[model samples]
Target: MPYKANVVVRYKKSVLEPQGQAILLSLREQGDESFLDVRVGKYIEILLEAENLQAAEEKVRKLAEDLLHNPVMENCSITVSQDD
Candidate 1:
């Protein structure tokens, strides 16, 4: 069956996110001080054929590790589900 994988990639806590910081600064300038900080991340969706849920999850995780995120500075989370 076909499966859908959702991947979220974000910088590690130790890494600085310049883009997010810039956004936060802009918001503050606009009088939105409610947000103390902001962090930017990437979201990706992949569709593939898999034998089972386990297989789909494993495949998506591998893809996230190898291509979706940078291990040195980033972490990734993945979710796998059936494609309707």
Candidate 2:
């Protein structure tokens, strides 16, 4: 079976995000004031072949916690879906 994993990485609310602020400023300057309060984060989608959804989800969660995110100042969420 094939599984798709989505990893969303974001800085903790208590952490200051300079990159997100910079991007937000740039967007505002470009006349997208609608994004004035928007916070930017990293998004990644991956495809994997696994024996089952549970296994795929476990692997994806570890990948997010161990390699995809900085546990020190970031929080990560992962979702896994099976492909029929």
Question: What C-alpha lDDT values do all the predictions have?
Answer: 0.91, 0.87
**TM-score to true structure, per model:** 0.91, 0.82
Kindly report which residue stretches of model 2 are placed more than 4 angstroms away from their true locations once superposed: 27-36
Total clashing pairs for each candidate: 0, 0
Model 1 lDDT-worst window of ten: 59-68
Residue 62 Cα positional deviation in candidate 2, in Å, after optimal superposition: 1.3
Query: How much is the lDDT of residue 66 in candidate 1?
Result: 77
lDDT of 2 at 12: 93
Candidate 1, 40-62: lDDT as tens digits: 99999899999999999988888
